[model samples]
Target: MAAAKSGGITAYSVKTKTKNVPMVDPVIDVKSGRYIATGKDADGNKMAAIMSKATAESHIEAGNAKKGSGWSK
Candidate 1:
């Protein structure tokens, strides 16, 4: 998995599931130290943005996404 990039900053997006259904769009903003989510769905509600990460073991972890993999530091 690749780190999400916005304006040259690295970040990670993780999705939480409930009963095999997506519940929220959890995003970790690296440069700003902010964890944001679009919140749960409500009646007649629409999400502005949706981002998610894979759940496989081979999938990139949130920590790795934030740190990147091409450098040693």
Candidate 2:
């Protein structure tokens, strides 16, 4: 389990049935009219979490992550 941060992005791992797995190197993407943050879990498995557009932009501009593919804003 990666160190969890307050107000940080987290993802659930279906393969491991883990909850609140911290996301590493998160990147924001717009898909189907939603903002999603994606990254890898502690086990190196891919994960994603739905987030607000404002949160996505803040994370991106804060140098915490990059805008993923299909990101229009």
List, residue by residue over 1-73, the lDDT tens digit for candidate 2. 2223564677678878988887778887788988878799878999878877777777777666778888753
lDDT (10s digit) by residue, model 1, range 1-73: 2223331212222332222222233333322332323323333232222223232112235432232222223
lDDT (CA) per prediction: 0.28, 0.75
Model 2 / residue 16 / CA error / Å: 2.0
Q: After superposition, how far is residue 64 of candidate 1 from its true place, in Å?
A: 19
How far in Å is the alpha carbon of 5 misplaced in model 1?
Answer: 30
Assess every candidate by TM-score.
0.19, 0.73
Angstrom error at residue 53, model 1: 15
How many residue-pair clashes does candidate 2 contain? Answer: 0
Q: Spell out the clash pairs found in candidate 1.
A: none
Evaluate model 1: give its TM-score: 0.19
